[model samples]
Target: MQPILSLDGVAKSYGGVKALTSGALDLYCGQVTALLGENGAGKSTLVKIITGIVHADGGTITLDGKPVVIESAEHARSLGISAIFQEPVVFDALTVAENIFITGRPLKGRSVDWPTMMRRSREILAELDPSIDPAMVLGRLSVAQRHLVQIARALSNDARIVIMDEPTAALSHREAEELFAITRRLRDEGRAILFISHKFEEVFALCDRYAVFRDGAGVGQGTLQGMSSERLITLMVGRPVDQVFPKQVVAIGEEVLRVEALGRCLEYENVSFDVRRGEILGVYGLIGAGRSEVMHALFGTAPAETGRIVLNGETVSIRSAQQAIAHGIGLVPEDRQRQGAHLRLAIGDNITLPSLGRTTRGGFLSARREREQAAPLAEQLGVKMSGLRQRVEDLSGGNQQKVVIAKWLATAPRVLILDEPTKGIDVGAKAQVHRLMGELAAKGVAIIMVSSELPEVLGMADRIMVMRRGLVQGIVPRSEATPERIVKMATDA
Candidate 1:
């Protein structure tokens, strides 16, 4: 069967660097195609080209057996192409109906037809999710609901080729299931869909076909039937990933930090745990379980209303992040893009931002000192970059995460907190991050890892702390921890 949309030898370059050397993809009506790749594999570039965010330097795009050039985002929309990002782009101040028709509203004799617009919005939303109110303010809706509104917009535009770019990245498991339902509905309606994700489970569960990109080129594409994840990994990185979680054995030493009875109103309560030298204490829980909230409190970003922190056997009050850093603590937050890295800053600058005191002479910043400090950390973390002068925004997701870790490492904190450290990265990058955690633990840096992936926590953590509904269920040692036991502890009352 012929594909509804097909691209041959699509390529894009930037200032002498090729972002996409040879991109290829096919989206068929009534099917979901999984775009699989490691970071920097040109998937983003290909998506941009298709969506008209960037024009390809070399390639042929065919729609319904005819060649075409997608000139801009508006043009792409007009051509029945629409993309829904992880974070739905909608105006918070606008009503759901207003946002649905923001691009083009119904008009009766020059003036806007409010009743017609509202009716159309309700009709579109009813198809996706009838519970959503067309008259409700967009900001008042949950993340999942906002995504539904975005889909409604796509439907309103009569989009036939829809691209979902990590749509479940910010969603809960239940919400993701709901999205999968919506996706199937779209496919059944004879619309072609492209699903871009880092999750193998999600890909295998929802996609009917597969396409893999590596090193800026499309290396493989085939049906998902009879395809093992191992084969897919091999195709993505050009080699077998023997171990995605390379956890190394390290000696557990004296306790370095402890929290007792930590509590925050409506967030978390009575959370208590301790991390020792050369120990990896993994915190596991479902979404909204308060795992991150406790970490935020410990890091002083969100101080607990009721609790006492003991650092090296001494009680201390950490009311701010600076205080936490001064107390020899560092936290790599879950949302790296918004909370961890300075996107516009140079790599060297971001690395040394937390330790500017050491990189300054006579209250003045020293670029040489900053470079001297950042270079080794970047190299140690194996951050792939042209130079220290390169902006953090230009690096891949994996490299950007490494930069965040390196930034915290520069502080030389006795205790390190990593929240979803490997989230959204591919198998290759996940392994690297795990390896780094092992190395850090071996060097006697007390580590606390907060992760949602069960295998990752079980593989790397020396001890696991389970949280449920803002409360600690239990803390199980690695030897005693099993998937069933942990899941029960997290979900069971």
Candidate 2:
């Protein structure tokens, strides 16, 4: 069967650096192709080329068995191509109907046909999700509903080739399932879909074919049938990942942090756990299970309404972040882009932000002292960058995560709370993070890691704490923990 869209030897270069050396892909009608790659592996470049955001320097793009040069976004849209990003790019101030027809609205005799526009929006939204009202304001809808509106817009434009880039990154499990259902519907409707994601589970569940890219070149492509995740990882990184977890056994020491009967109204309650020196305590739970809420409470970002926090065998009251920091506690939040790091700030500045007191002299901040303090942390975390002056926004997802970790490490905290530390990073980055966690544990830093991935929790934690609906289900040692047991404990009513 011939592909509806195909690329051969696609190449792009910025100045002297090559972004894509020999990119290639094929999108067939009635199928979802998974675009798998590590961060900065030319996946974004390929998407931009296809969407006409940037023209490829070298390559042959074929559509309908004929070579084509997509000149602009308008031209790509005209050719039935549309892209839905992780964050829906729509005006929240506009109504659902207005957003659906923002680019082109119905007009009757030079006057905008409001009734016709509303009717068409209703028809499109009804096909995707009948529960969504066309007259509702876009801002009032949930993130998942906004995504449905984006899909409605694509259908309104008669898009035949749709690209979904990390569409489920910000969604809950149920929301992701809903998106998957819509994806299958689009495929059944004879649309060629390109799905780009870091999640292997989603790839296996929703995609029929796979394409792997590494170092700006296509390394592998074939049907997803009979393909193991290990094989796919090897293809993406160009080597066998013998130890994806790489958890190191460190000498467990005395208890460093303890919580007794921690509770917060409408969030979490009666959460109690203790982390020993040089121990990794993995917190596992489903979404809204209050795993992150407990972490936030411990970090004093949101103080627990009822509980006792014991640090080094001494009960302490931590009602603010400053008090938590003073008590030698640190937290790496789940949403790194929003809460963990300063995106627009320089890497050195962000790292030193938590430890500004040490970087100041004579009641003034010193750049020399700041670099002296942050440079070593960045290097220790293996943060790849042009220079210390470079902004954190310019780094890849993996490197940005490292920067966030570095920022917290600078605080010299005895207890570190990591909320979804490897949430959106690639396999290589995940291994690096696991290794760092091992190193930190070896240094006798008590760590509490909140993760949604079962394998990660099992691999990295010396002990696992399971939570369900703002309550502690059970705590199991690593030696006795199994996937089935953990899942049962987390999901059981």
Candidate 3:
């Protein structure tokens, strides 16, 4: 079958750095093609080039076997290509209907066709995503709903090709199912789908054919039929990644962190959990289920309306993150880029920021001590950088996450709280993080992990706590916890 879209000898570069070398990609009608790579391995650059967000330095692109010049995003869209980015690009003030038909609204003689737009918007959105209200503000909707709006916009434009970059990254299993359903509908309609994802399961489930990129070049390509998850990781990283989850089994010590009847106004209530030294307590919930709220409250980033927290067997008042840190509790928050790291700072500076007091003499940081302390931690975390002097901004998503982990680890907290720590990282980094978590737990540190990914929760947690709307649904031992039951509890009122 002829490919609906094809790139031949495509190449792009930034200064001396090659984002993508000469490479070929094909996406056929009624098929999904997954583009898999480690972050900075050229996947994003390739997508940008294909979508005309960035022009290729050298190559040829053919749509329906006809050479095309896609110089801008508008040109790409006009050529029937649409992309849903990793981070959603939607204006908060606009209604769903308005955003969907922003540029291409049906017109009636120099006047906006309000009635036609409303009717058509409702109809098109119902076909793509029925649950969303077209009248609702785009920003007011959940991440999943906004994603659907993006899809509706593409469909409304009559796009023959759609690119989804990490679409399932933030979605729950239920929301992902809806997305998969939409993908099938698009495929049946003969649209070419290009899927970019880190999760091997998602790739296997969605893509008919897939390509792997490594070190700025396409390394492998084939049907997903005979490919195993382990083999896929091996191809992407150029090394055998035998296991994705490297969970550790450490003997649980005495309870070091305890939450008693924790409640945050209108967010979470009566959330109670315990984490013993040398133990990992996993918190699982759908987005907006208040898991993050409870964690934030515990860490004192958000105030608790009513609750008591006992750490190291002492009842403590944590009014701020500094107080929590002083109490020997460290938190790696969900938004690492915004909250965790100082992007402009060097890798060593970020890693050592939390424990600078140890390297300080009379209120001044000892540069020598800071450098000496940070080097080992960065190395231990396998952070890829030229040296400690390299800026954090230049690192990949996985490496950046490692820097965040290194930052908190330097604090030597008795209890550690990680909120979506492995989020947006590659498989190799995820495994390493899992390994590090295990090592930290083994050192008698109590760990509380909040994650949306079921596999990570199941694999790493000594016990699982499932949360629903503003409440703890149930806590289960790892041996008894399964994906189905966890999902049920997470959605259960």
Candidate 4:
């Protein structure tokens, strides 16, 4: 079969930063091509080039064997190519139906066909999954909902080629399955799908053929029929990654953090749980099942009105995040880009921001002390960067997550609360983080991990607490926890 799209000697750069160098790739009709890479490995940059968000400096782009220069995103769209970004691009002012048909609404003669658009949007969403609300404002929808709208927008254009970047990063297991079904439907209809993801399992399950990217260039490409997950990981990282999960055994100590009858207005209620000194307590729930809110309540970001927080056998009232930190508690929030790190700041600056005062003497910063503290943590986290002076925005998604954890590690807290720490990170970096968590637990630091991924909770937790609709449905030991049991507790009011 002829290639639907092809790139020859493609290159892109941002000022002095070379994102892609001498790269080549191809997309064929009615097939799913998985693009694998580490954070900052230039995956996003390459997608931008294909979508005409950024023009490539040197390359030949051909559609259907004819050379073409896509001057802008509009030009790319005109040629029946569309890209769904890592972050869902939705206009908050528009409704879900409007956002889905934003480019060009279905028309009836001279007037806009509102009924047709709404009906068509509903049909598209039903094809994906029928739970979405068409009349709801885009601003009011969840991350998952916005992602569906973005996909619907691409389908509305009748695009022959579609590029999805980290499409399942924000989805739950069930939602991800639904998305895979939709992708297969698109493929069966002869649409070419370029799928980018960090999860090798998803890639292997969905892609007909896949390619690995390392240091801004394609490393390997082949059919997935006989490919092992191990081989793909080796190609992406240039080393053996035999195990994806890195759960370490540790002795559980006495409870170091405890909550009794925790309630936060209408957000969550009666959420009681505890984490021991040398154990990880995993909190599992659907998005908005009060997982993130529970973390906020514990950290004093969203104060609990009717709960007793006993830390190390003493009742403590945490009214603010500062008070929580002072009481030997540190929280790595869910949204890293917004709450965890300062994107414009240097990596070193972000790493030390939580404990700057501790490293200072006589009201002056100790630069030497700061570097000494950050360097080892960065190394341990395996952050691929030139130096600590590099801007956080320049780092990959995995590296940025490491910086967030490093910042909290600098605080030297007794109890660490990590909310979705490995959300967007790759398989290798995720293992490193899990290893670090084990090491910290062995050192007597209590850990509370809130995650939506079922496998993550099942693999790393010493005890699992399942929540459903603002209430604790059940708590089980890791040995007894299964996806079925957790899902039951998470949805069984």
Candidate 5:
């Protein structure tokens, strides 16, 4: 079968730095083709080249077996190609109807045609979701709803090839399911879907074919039916990873953190859990189960109004993150892009930011000490980078995560809080992170991990604590932490 779109020898460079050496892909109608790679492996560059955001240094693009020149984003849109980014690029000021019809609102003799636009918007959106009101402001909708509007706009524009870049990165499990269903509908309608993501489970579940890129080159491309997840990881990383989860059993010691009836009105109430030295306690729950909220209170992101937090047998009141740090607590938030790391800063700076006091002498910061303190952690975590001066934002998703973990580890806290540590990373990276966690546990650093992936909880956690409506449903050992038991615990009151 002829491909609807194909790229031959697609190459790109920036300031003499080659971003892509030989990028290539083929998108066929009625198929979801996954673009797989590490964060800096040239997947985004290829996407940008196809979307006309950046001009390729050298390549031939054939659409329907005919050579075509795409000069700009508008040109790509005109050719029935549209992209929905990780964060939906929608106009917050405009209503849902206006956003869907922004490309070409129905014109009426030099006047805006609001009625026709609304009707058309409603019609297109009805296919995906009928509950959304076309007249509602785009900013008023939830994150998932905003994504739906983006999809509706692509469909309304008569897009034949749609690109989804990490569509489920921020969505909950339930929301991701909805997006997956809509993607299937588009595939059934004969539209070519290009799905780019880091989650192995999602790629295996949603994609029919895959094009794998590694170090700015295409390594493999084929149907998903016969491929194993390990092979896919190897292709993405150019290495044979032994195990994705390197869990190590350590002797659990004295309790490092003791929370007594931690409660915040309307969010969570009477939540209590204990973490022992060298142990990882995994927090499992559905959305609104108050998992993150509990962590927030524990780490002083959002303090609990009523609770007694005892660290090392000393009752301490942590009113801010600074105080928490003073009490030897560290937290790596779920949203690494926002709360965890400073994107514009270099790796050394980000890692040593929290431990600046240690790197200072007589009220002056020591660059040598900063490097000495951060270099080992980065090396131990196997952070891939050209130099310590490289910006954190330029690294791949997995490397960026490594930088985040390095920052917290530099503090050398007795207790570490990891919220969704491997949210948007490849399988190999996930394995590396799991190994790091196991190593940390062996070093006697108590870890509190909050995650939605049941398998991850079952794999790495010493104890699984299921939360429901701001309460602890049950705490079970690893031997008893089955999916059925966890699900039941999460759903039960």
Candidate 6:
């Protein structure tokens, strides 16, 4: 079969560092190709090269068997290439139809036709899903609805090739299924799809072909039809990963945290759980299951309307995040980019932000003290960077996650709440995080892990607390927990 798009020896470099050593791929019409790679394996760089966010240093990019230069994102879109990012871009204040037509509205006789815009938008939206109203404001729509709107906008552009990057990262199982259906329809309609995701199940379920990247180079490409899952992993990591989810059995100690009758209107109610020292309590739930909400309240990011929080058998009032930190609690929020890291700061500065007081000399911070504290944490976390002076934002997603974890770990918190700690990270990074959790648990830190991935919950948690619609359904021990059981608990009313 002929490729709709092909990139040969596409290369990119940054400050003498190679970002894409040999970026290569082939996207065929009527097929969904899974782009597999660890974070920093050049997948994102290749995406940028294709979309013209950045120009390639050297390569042959061919569209329709003819060499071409993608001058810009606008040029790529004009040439039937469109990308849907993990975070859907939409104008919140604008109507759904307005957002769809923002790129290029249909022409009317001498002026922008608002009515025709809305009408055409509704037609395009119906092709994906009809639940969204074209005239309705986009801000009121759900994330899933916003995704559909983005897809509708792409189709409106007459896009022949679509790139979906981690589309299911934040979606529930049902929502993911809906997206899969839409993706398959697009494939059947002869649109070439490039799907980038870290999930094996999603790739197997939705993609027809597979291509892997390792250390900024294309390592493998083939049909996924008879590919073993293990072989896929080996191709991605460039080596055998002995343990994907490394969990350790640790000695349980005194109770570290206890929550009873925790309540927040329209979020969660009557939530109760206990975390003992050296134990990981995994919280598993659907998107709106209030897992993050409960953790937010516990971490003091959002105080609960009513609840009893006990720390070390003593009742403590945590009115804010400062108080939570002061009381030996730390939270690595779900959205690390916006909520966790200070992007503009250096890696060392971010890691030492919470421990500023400890790094103070007289009345001001000591640079030496800060570096001393940050260096060990960064090294311990296996943060790959030139130095601590590098901007945290410049690091890849996995490295950024490491910095976030290192930041909180610098504080030496007795209780840690991690919300989707490994979301969007590579397999190696995920395994490293799991190993870190095991180490922390062994050291008697009461950990509360809120994750959407069932495998993570089952592999790491000593006990799983399943929540459904703002309530705890059941708490099952690791021995008794399975994907089916946890899913049932998460979905059942």
- Report the number of the highest-TM-score candidate: 2
lDDT by residue (1-493, candidate 2, tens digit) is 9999999899999999899999999999999999999887999999999999999999899999999999998899989999999989999998999999887788999988999999999899878889988999899999999899989989988999999999998898789999999999999999999999988889999999999999999998989999998899999987676667889989999999999999999999998989999999999998999999899888888999998999999999998899999999999999999999999999999999988899998889999999899999999888999989999999999999999999999999999999999988988888889999999999999999999988899989999999999999999999999999999999883
Which stretch of 10 consecutive residues in model 1 shows the poorest summed lDDT?
A: 238-247
lDDT of each: 0.93, 0.93, 0.87, 0.87, 0.91, 0.91
lDDT of 5 by residue, 68-107 (tens): 8789998999899999988999999999998887887898
- Error in Å for residue 36 of model 4: 1.9
For residue 71, give model 1's deviation from the true position in Å: 3.8
Per-residue accuracy of model 4 over 1-493 as CA lDDT, tens digit each: 8889988778988899899986678899999999887766678888888888899999899999999998889889889999887679899988999999888888999988999999999988887758888888889887777887888999888899999988887777677787788889999999999999877668878999987778788787767899987788788777776455667788888989889999989899988988888999999998778889988888898899898999999999998999988898999998999999999999988999878886688989888888989998999888888999999999877789999999988888899999998988877777888888989999999999998878788888999998877989888999999888888888773
* Predicted candidate 1 versus true structure: per-residue lDDT over 1-493, tens digit per residue: 9999999899999998899999999999999999999888899999999999999999899999899999999999999999999889999999999999888899999999999999999889888889888999899999999999889989989999999999999898789999999999999999999999988879988999999999899999979999998899899988765667778888899999989999999999998889999999999999999999999898899999998999999999999999999999999999998999999999999999999999999999999999899999999988999999999999888899999999999999899999999998877888889999999999999999999888889989999999999999999999999999999998893
Off by over 4 Å in 1: 109-111
Cα-based RMSD of the predictions, in order?
2.3, 1.4, 3.2, 3.9, 2.4, 2.4
TM-score per candidate, chains pooled: 0.92, 0.97, 0.87, 0.83, 0.92, 0.92
Question: lDDT by residue for model 6 over 361-423, one digit each (tens)?
Answer: 898988899989999999998999999999989998889999999999999999999999999
Worst 10 residues of 6 by lDDT: 237-246
Superior candidate under TM-score, 1 versus 3:
1
Cα lDDT, model 4, residue 17 = 82
Better of 5 and 6 by lDDT: 6
Better of 3 and 5 by TM-score: 5
Prediction 3 global C-alpha lDDT: 0.87
Q: For model 1, what is the C-alpha lDDT against the true structure? A: 0.93
